[model samples]
Target: MIAVWKEWAGEKLNESEWLSLLDLAQRESAEEDALVRGDLPVPPPPVSGHPRVTPPPPAPRHKVPDTPPPRPSTELDDRFGPWLARQLRRSGLTQSDLAMELGLTRAAVSAWVTGRAEPRSEVRRQVAKVLGGVQQFAPLERWKTGAAVLIGVSEYTHLPSVPSIKNNLSALTEVALTGLGIPHSNVHTVENPTSAAQVHEKIDLAMEAADPVSGGLFIYYAGHGWTDPRNGRLLLGLVESNQHKTWTAMEFDRLREQIADSPVGSRLLVLDSCYSGAALDTLSAGLSSASRIEGTYVMTSSNATNASRAPQGDHFTTFSGEIIRSLTDGIQGGPRVIDTDTLFRHVRASCEEQGWPVPSRQIGRDGDRVELMSNRWGQP
Candidate 1:
């Protein structure tokens, strides 16, 4: 009967409503079982209703049917306020102490502590930072159900070809499949896209092909990144991209909008291109101005004014090379899964040590817990 309802309800309702309907049915079924088992009291029926419905007949003690429970989907935001309050007390710090540290008013901190106003994702990250602790990673199952778009621009018509791009694409693909455990079918790749239109099409196809229930959407771009001299808007270059002609390249904001609009619960973006770091303001741009419903993590090669390094004779570009290293060599003593921010920290430290362009990073909402790959050596 539930299956029949699901079939009819699914056709009539949206995904969210259908899921809610199923959840309601599941709850009702559980309550009915509890009533039959005498675990709950049957509510008194009213005579004014359309008709009086008979309650379920009692069954044998051992014959109660087993039904799966609904998955826990409650937002963790409700707990954050209390958790922050507790952490502050445990650390023996007053609200003023935190306010000073975060450069906010005491009242603002109090709001967060009292659950009057919730901190945004970035602010939550800062809160975690002020009260320092090791980052906890998400479960490995998240990435196993995730999707990725590996884009490489190796050969350009108006620009010089960076032969290293092909390696970047192939290597990241391997990481996504093996270390990340993402299905090969869900991993999309576009190489040497000829025009900006093609890049847009590829993005559309990726969004269309990605499963609606996908755990996360991971997009990586390794190519020439240009900034519009007129407006300073970062552009992801294509084969036909002209450094001077702004219309020739795909604007970073376009990709940002697309990802923000995606239904995927988590998002991770990796860019190994010059001036890529300028696009880090994606989540803060428009939607929430911008909204991060699930998770958002971005790793960029260099700052807005800096150019990324492509070391000669290296297997991959400098920024992407460190990423490949993290994947192939799982961090020892890390958590069960390698979260995106963890990977970024590892890559940033490595790049800094080598005197290479340090990668820029941003983590918002639950992005810190968004896992990407398995830890070859770590505890659960």
Candidate 2:
């Protein structure tokens, strides 16, 4: 019946809605069974408003059904917020103390402690790290299903292509898949996508293989970028992208919508191209002024107005190379899990030291953390 309704409605329900529909239906069925078994009172019939003829019933109020609770993914954010709050108190750290340590505002720290707000994915990872150091906390569990799409375009038809992009792709694939131990079959690679259609197709294929329920998704792209002259929008350079032909470029806005619509619980997008931050601007435009999408993490190699770096004689682009290095070496401390926040901080500092364009980062929501690589076996 639900499938039939979806067919007639011309839209399938999201996972949350589908699960709620099933739960509500099950409860209704149980109630009907109880009525048939003579263990419950029958609901009263509606009274007619008309004097002689029965009046048509009022439309049903489609109140949103109660959703099931989400499974706990972390200690501080999920099941034991209050307990973690207590732990923070016992650790002799004031709300300000914790805030200063995490480089967050005291209000933000208070929100997490008082259950008013959850820590963003990277923040949550740091929370676990900080708390774990002061106290014996449980280690974070790795996602059961992990998938990645590594795309590179070194050969372009119109634009000055980013050279050695294939090297970037190869190194990234190894870092994310082989070095990180993401299943070989779960990783998708697209080399030199020649047109917009090819790029979209590969992204769609990767998303299709991803499982939002149990795991995460990782998307990495290394290429050139151009701002659409007509509207100041950013465009990703495909193999056939032409600076004069707007249609030939992949609009970063459309790419963002694709990632935003993904069902994955955790998503990591790493864009090693110029002006990729414009995509975040597109997503954040409006009265809200802030972009907040749950479970998505983005790291762009350069801001919307800056040029990304490609150091001479390097096999990979500067920003991309630094990111890969941080992931492989593990950030100074033994943070077994390398979150984007940690890696981006490292990258930004490195860029500043070397006079390269600093990278930009955005986190959509809390609890969407994706572990880039495990540092347990030590660096390779």
Candidate 3:
């Protein structure tokens, strides 16, 4: 949008300090009102070569904001990745579903979504129709304003290695989450953190990177997890984490406190390890009225008592793999842009059907609206 505006305004637009035309117009009106009310002095009009600005044509009000103006179909074709990804997300259609419908391979759909390949003209039209036409997908503001800190400990110092944890980290940060339009630069990772301080360091950086008002922070931990036997407090294993020495592990409540104190109001935590669901009790208190944080949410791989799975030989852990599958494949009957609530439902259902430990979550204020990814179910 800024690029489009820059192309239109050219010399008139200040690249350093960019403000929306609507904001400028509103600010002008407010200044005029203040002048009329004797609250601010009215400046004399420029007497030289300065030109008075003309207001932009009125924008027709619509149910959605940030809806782009109509452009040539060729232009849409040029941005096939964004267009295809958006429709898939909004329609909740899966790559496999679309592939089956078009009698093409799922690889073809994935290529289209990722912009590695484009569909033929006729096929593009078919896809547009299948996903409720070629309407613009405008729910990306959340992704644009969001930042993530993914910490995965695949090879712990003392605990048994959950080798698939590496796959969980890579697939999520590099492939699945990026499909939602989050810039790769905005996603931070702590692959094999040595100590609790390193985990805190990554999260602190992510918090600093995100916008306090509109931006969100997503912190994911996928490795060995432990709970104190006496009180069930969740702890994430670091490289030197020991099962017997619980204090050697990264205390979740400590991380929770940092997140609660951070300026970013919208926050999410995705845990894919054993006893992760235990954070529910802690998050419930950490996100109470006393803290007054909004859009704080969680999704754990298992319940407070059960163990999460890694199957020994799979490329990805069972839980995180399911999440990647859900995002990539899309829920056929779900909403276009699936929120965490919707994601939890799909994951929980899959786990229940397979008799695996079910995922867990407790939605915070406006947490449902804090969408994490686009539903890929593009076809009915």
- Per-residue accuracy of model 3 over 36-146 as CA lDDT, tens digit each: 788853444655777544334434432212533232223233455655565466555678988987889999899987878887646754563444321223336666677
* TM-score order of candidates, top first: 3, 1, 2
Q: Hey, what RMSD does candidate 3 come out at?
A: 13.4
lDDT of each residue in 1-380, candidate 2, tens digit only: 22212222322345555443333333333444557788853333444663333222222325443454332222212323454465576544577877888898999887776677776545654664454444321222333266778888888887776676888888888876545545677788889987767766777776677676656778888898878878889888888888888888778777777766666767778888888777667765321222232366778888889888876567889888887777666677646566667677778999999888988887766523555555432422
lDDT computed for candidate 1: 0.70
**Which candidate wins on lDDT?**
3
Error of 2 at 334 (Å): 4.6
Q: How does each model score on TM-score?
A: 0.60, 0.59, 0.65
Clashes of 1: 1
Clashing pairs in 2: none
lDDT pick, better of 2 and 3? 3
Q: Scored by Cα lDDT, where does model 2 land? A: 0.65
The lDDT for every candidate, in the order shown, is 0.70, 0.65, 0.71
> Which scores greater on TM-score, model 1 or model 3?
3
- Model 3: per-residue Cα lDDT at residue 344: 81
Tens-digit lDDT string for candidate 1 (282-311): 546542333345567778999888999986
Which consecutive 10 residues in model 1 have the weakest lDDT in total?
57-66
